[model samples]
Target: MSTPNRVYLARLAGVAVFDPNGDQVGRVRDAVARMRATQRPPEVVGLVAEMPMRRRIFLSINRITSIDPDGVVLGSGTLNLRRFEKRPNELLVLQELLDRRVQLDSGHAGSVVDVAMECSRGGEWALSRVAVREHTGRLTRRGHLHQVDWDRVHGLGAVGDNRGTANLLAVLEDMRPADLANALQDLPDARRNEVAAALDDERLADVLSELPEHDQVEILAALDRQRAADVLEEMEPDDAADLLNELPPPEQDVLLDLMEPDEADPVRQLLRYASGTAGSVMTSEPVILPPDATVAEALARIREPQLSPAVAAQVFVTRAPLTTPTGRYLGMVHFQRLLREPPADLLGGIVVNDIDPLRTSTPLPEITRRMATYDMVSMPVVDRNNRLVGAVTVDDVLDHSLPRDWRDRDAVSPSSATHDGILDGDDE
Candidate 1:
């Protein structure tokens, strides 16, 4: 490869990645480096590129024809579609290192601004330079910028209480909640908490739901009681209930008490049901409308950007009260059916109640069987009084059915792993 002797990894973020034929494949997300046992600088692994559909895959540095500020050209088009998972001893350059608090060999406190990787004469790449900005301790003036050898920096190998997250969060701002969660799982525990803590309540709530249960519990615990309650309030009630279920009753109650009465009420109700039942896994906030609502109104409600695809796939129609515990559950209408109906038509005239709704106490196995038989993405759950209470989506069923710790499944050790991840890119 013909490239500059040194490349700043942070600047490469969002640079387009292309096939040899000049077709765009993805954009640079971050650089991966394998930490060394000795004082030697970490060896540069490859670039994590965000492909079409927000799928991130690894591209070996060896496959690159050239590298610059513009774009990365890949020698091969064949690519692995498997999701990228981080292995121990592997550091994500932008996510884990940037905005890190560090001290210079001269003992000046500063924070990492960027990192540069240099190519060796033998063709191997390694992180070799550090760009840091000194803490001016003055609000009127910006800090002094320093570009020094990687070895001249201290505190880069560990987390500090004063680390800044504004730069790191900026790089992650455009990512989807699930993608951001994957990136967070790759960070050191303390760094992960620091970054997660920096996100606003709504963003953190979205990311927390995507994270593994243990990670969710850990990040939530890292926050103060009031802030934790606020984040939980922003999450979907079912997700908030699911996360709270992981904590002991006393801890759960404390956070619940801190949440607003309206938000806490639905979650408290969800918590009342036994695990493995419909009520326990259903989302209390799925798209809901009254029977007298028009097709256009139902369409508009489903179009709300905050609604999950599964939740928005259909609209549950009921009588009177539109919220959970709504009066007289009246069935539902799929968005597809809505598209076929006149905008002025009332939902009550064409609702599909053919499939029976799951009762709160119904077992998950039965629910899954029925959903599969009916090809439904989501199914309504009601109370004995025939009032709409919640809706169980396919994702909820899968979450409960998967083995605990599935998110932490084993990956090939860093020592043995080839290009792309635990598995070789070619094989995957």
Candidate 2:
């Protein structure tokens, strides 16, 4: 067999892997490689193949006969049918490296769009170069695609995987949720989902809440069904409700069923309201305390780590049986009011009574105007009986006030002419 000088992994993927005597065995799922310390390319360990019955098995690199644009041909028809288990020293290109963010020595960061493999004189293959593409939005089809030597590009995940590069995930993990969400927005879909999946539930929830509605839908859909429900449960009810609104009824029902009943109930209540109303955008988990509680107690409640800045800025004073939508809406106490007063002073005496609570059905525009007019970071929402049901934080209000299509302004060009060599000429 004539050994090809070079081939692209992206082109190799999905190609039919054939056995000796020209019988098809399976399709190439991924390539495994072990990094090298010297300047030499990382040796191609083997190929992971998906055969009939969706069975994934491994083919040793020693058995590969030829590398060509058509596919990989085996040295022999005999192949192991056992499940493929990843060894600690090996990395799966598709699962761990493809589409990963890589920084070149020139200080420009791009994505590993595809990997280039070359045949050695001794009949072995090694990853030689990586196709680094400047990523754009989902609709943006073409960008600058550079073929850079693998030695010049650093894998950010390698450190986390204890393979190469510095501890990049640790650095990114420290970013604020909004900042992290924005950073993830620029990545390709595969890389974005991989990063999102790596974050912890609470952190992932915070990041998801900060993302645009369309992105929220995409990321949530990418997560495991049970994991998606868990992340939704961690988010504020208002944020969770808004995300759920993006899904079709069938998917929404599936996630809701997976969530704890108590957490799911509030989101359901919010969904019952008109799309752009106070109830629909309000958080069911407001900071509420009985009127008799001391200023000291209120301050402690505000310090809870999970409380958002908007909710922690004040405490609502209510009567007993304090479920969300409490039994009675009495008054409120600003955190400033708590500061000047003695720690032992009961909240009832100094509670501010003049503040008017919003009705559940109050239109979003009115809610916005009221919040602006009163200089309030948050406003209470009440039921028909004047019972406190929830509070609409300023952040949620601001998000709703933006134009519906505001998040979609970044456009992508999908024309094929710009991405040379990335696609097969026959594909057009």
Candidate 3:
């Protein structure tokens, strides 16, 4: 038979798969590939399908008889593929990848959507992290087309097997920190701490920030004083301060000592602020530029791969000796504005000082009101000295204060409360 055109899994995103006689099987939910134990092209392991009634099923690649751009051709007739079940000593299917974060070859990052299972050559069923999908569109179209092998999985957590429950604690004992952090989120608090305690300072720090404050406290309390301090020091100052606030004074003091003076000082300052304050939430890590810098220079800095979106968005403009330490606050230039203007224009020319700014101490209500009033995505937080301290975006405020259901529940009312009631009884 002639080989069909090389159709990529990405291009087949919305395509359908059919049986040999051309009966519809299912739509292609996702294509999965597994890394070979030895050096070899990762084999297409299976395809996840969105079946009828919102049900999902996995079809093994071995059952595929042909491939075409239009749809996948399966060798089997229309039959529901059997789901792999976890047996004694077998890895849990769902636990292996469910909710654990993964990096796709395409540079997009996301947690596992679901795992695909199939029976291996020896008549035993196997589970693997086959498909990864991201919620964000950070990676471009070309980047999204690439696929990675399961072996390339840099990190993973102790996920349960196909069974509802398994001994994940034992599996977590040997995993790395980031992987453990990803996995611990789904585990009970007790098991999560057990896995956290085994992580190194850096890994613990990374994982701690990803967890909720309650979990952070639980894990921190379980760690030895020295290890806990080391982890706090490695974390961002704001994050460290947040965690420290949850600890008792004596423990907090000891952890502070473990951090370098430079790292400890800023964190201590942040700790002094109230929770939910801009000062407590903001990172001092921002890009500062002088008003004299050409739009070209600012654009270059923003475009650099090293700078993150948050840092790149608001470019601060200062006075001429571009590096003038005491230059008066000019204004902020947004990326959208910068992109619209010529690169050669001076940043000062584009500066708009009339913008609304927020004080570090501003309450959530006021901050939200200002955001809504100005129709702003983010507002810069500054101190009494007019020095930029942090920023609060609309998302940050809404995450805390926005009503889940703001629509009027009482909008629908009875037409009459008195006379109509009696009239209805008489009208039959």
Candidate 1 residue pairs in backbone clash: none
What lDDT is obtained when candidate 1 is compared to the true structure? 0.87
**Per-residue lDDT for 71-116 in model 2, tens only?**
7889743466655656656667655665567778877766776787
Expressed as tens digits, the lDDT of each residue in 1-428 for candidate 3 is 12233333433444677877887866764455444465433444556554442233556655676665688777643444433222232232333444456666656665554443333454323343345545465555322322345555534433432221222333343443434454565455665666577666776787786555667888888887777778888886666876788788887888898878877877776677676676666554445678778888888888886444655776777544332122455678888898899989998889877975677777777877887887776677767766666566554565446342221111112221211111223210
Question: What does candidate 1's lDDT look like per residue over 1-428, in tens digits?
Answer: 86799999988987888888998888899998989999999999788887764556777777788888889888854665566666779888888788889889988888888999999999999999999989999989888899999999987777456568988887788877977887787677988898999999999999998888899999999999999999999999999999999999999999999999999999999999999999999999888888889999999999999888999999998887888899898889999999999999999999999889999999999999999999999999999999999999999998888776655413212232334533343531
What Cα-based lDDT does every candidate model obtain?
0.87, 0.77, 0.58
How close is every model to the real structure, measured as TM-score? 0.83, 0.60, 0.52
Rank ordering of all candidates by TM-score, starting from the highest: 1, 2, 3
- Cα displacement (angstroms), candidate 3, residue 406, comes to 18
Candidate 2 has what TM-score?
0.60
Candidate with maximal TM-score? 1
TM-score of candidate 3 against the unseen true structure: 0.52
- Top-lDDT candidate index: 1
